[model samples]
Target: MTVMTDRPHMTTEEFEDLARIAAQQAEGLRLEFIGGVLRSKAMPDGDHGRVILWLTRICMQHHPDFWLHPGQGIKAEQYREGRAIPDGVLAHEDAFVGQGDWVDPGPILMAVEVTSWDSDTERRDRIERPRAYAQTGIPVYLLIDRLKCQVLVHSDPDGNGYETVRTVPFGKEVKLPDPVGITLHTEPLKDWVR
Candidate 1:
């Protein structure tokens, strides 16, 4: 059995390095630095993965210029001194370079998060993350809440959080504004099991 130890009060850079090393050691695990803390989570489950797949397909079919990356870590230098790993990220083809593992939030067009089983996870996805993304000036933030069966589209960042917030139920379609400019069919999301 592997032993796990907690390193308290680590700086952002230290946390990021630890996360990178941990990810390399455990291939399937995803580790992120959030608010100076190292947060680790398992790879997404079936339903979560399905939503990401559908989002990728939709983006490819409608907005070919944008690149949809699933399970990628985005670094927000201006926000909370941490890196966030969103469920899905939509950005321009040339937004990221080949050098680093983390993508800067500046080039990211939209960041997507799917709510998980834990309440802490849900709170982070719904509240904390949106604030972080907005502070980083990422244009849009999309949240898929499986527990609530709804999708929230957040835009108009104001450093602290979004100024505009729109919500749509699972069956309804959510029209992504301007740069993205496409309607997302959220029907398939309704079929999410737990």
Candidate 2:
């Protein structure tokens, strides 16, 4: 599929087909189909990326069955052209398929997003997008804001969107609802700030 970005553009059909090809052709390059164009975002910086890696590892270690997808875009609405590739998305019960045009509308147990430096984006991820996920009935959306050294968990998704149930700072406790009943400690993650 051809990824539409920058000034030059292509028809939506072209981008979707090419994006799938990108994922299949290269193992390292992560491709996501967004707005009918495959948008390949920059690879996360070493420290920031590692933070996401560690978190995925921890989640997988605790929940052995879930498939941990980092940088894989979820097809929130295939027909409507709504899509987002979350930082860390847990596909429970379904094994990871290497290439797919769309993902299931899920009651995804957890969706974790790591924020960038922009204040606008901070609000988008923390509030806007999560609300969309909540409206879709995703149970938990976790935001790890490396810029602010805070972890925000959005829980109890009502009909409209997610409500802020609890939030924790760098040194405080961060516990998310899970199948296995485990509360995690985040002080060790402080080192990834840089």
Candidate 3:
């Protein structure tokens, strides 16, 4: 069921179709088309899920205008026709009209990814995903690297990548910039996988 290839060369519609079919069959697995390639990963472990829950809770309590979505697909037109399924996403409350699965990157306020157990997954989360998000002009990209026990916030996308990057350790609070102005409490994020 792995869809990782050198050049998938799938159209946006084709990618979406594949993702829809995959979602119907697999419950915890996420299939995404990123950077002209199809990629798949299983659901996150306990710590990763906890981190996302905490962030979602905080956003719900503090930010009334924003909506927090866990495990959703985001379509970024700039990245050679691929959809990205980030670990968590924060967007305007009215970003989507109805009960649909896919969302465009234009209305996205932030995209978040928690580092996975696999090294290849970690590499894609740390490197390729951010570039793809930036190319789509996503305002902010957050990486929760449990392996490094640090959180990295990237903003001000310059087409190719983000220009401003701020990294902080687990116990520190990293401030998200305007529009999504809030501080993320990273102290409770335990590296469950070692």
Query: CA lDDT of each candidate?
Result: 0.79, 0.66, 0.81
As a whole number from 0 to 100, the lDDT of residue 167 in candidate 2 is 76
lDDT of 1 by residue, 113-162 (tens): 88878647765887778888888888889898888999999999898789
lDDT measured at residue 82 in model 3 versus the true structure, 0 to 100 = 69
User: Candidate 2 has which clashing residue pairs, if any?
Assistant: 1-17, 1-18, 1-19, 2-18, 73-85
Model 2 lDDT per residue over 1-194, tens place = 96545532554456567666776898756554443343454456777788787887787788887755776566552243446677777766464555465465563677778776654565557655676577666677888878878888877888467665677888887778753244668886698886
- What TM-scores do the predictions have? 0.89, 0.73, 0.88
Clashes of 1: 0
Greater-TM-score candidate between 1 and 2: 1
Ranking by lDDT: 3, 1, 2
Return the TM-score for candidate 3, rounded to 2 decimals.
0.88
Off by over 4 Å in 3: 1-7, 77-80, 191-193
Candidate 2: where is the Cα deviation over 4 Å?
1-42, 77-81, 96-99, 118-120
C-alpha root-mean-square deviation, candidate 3:
3.0
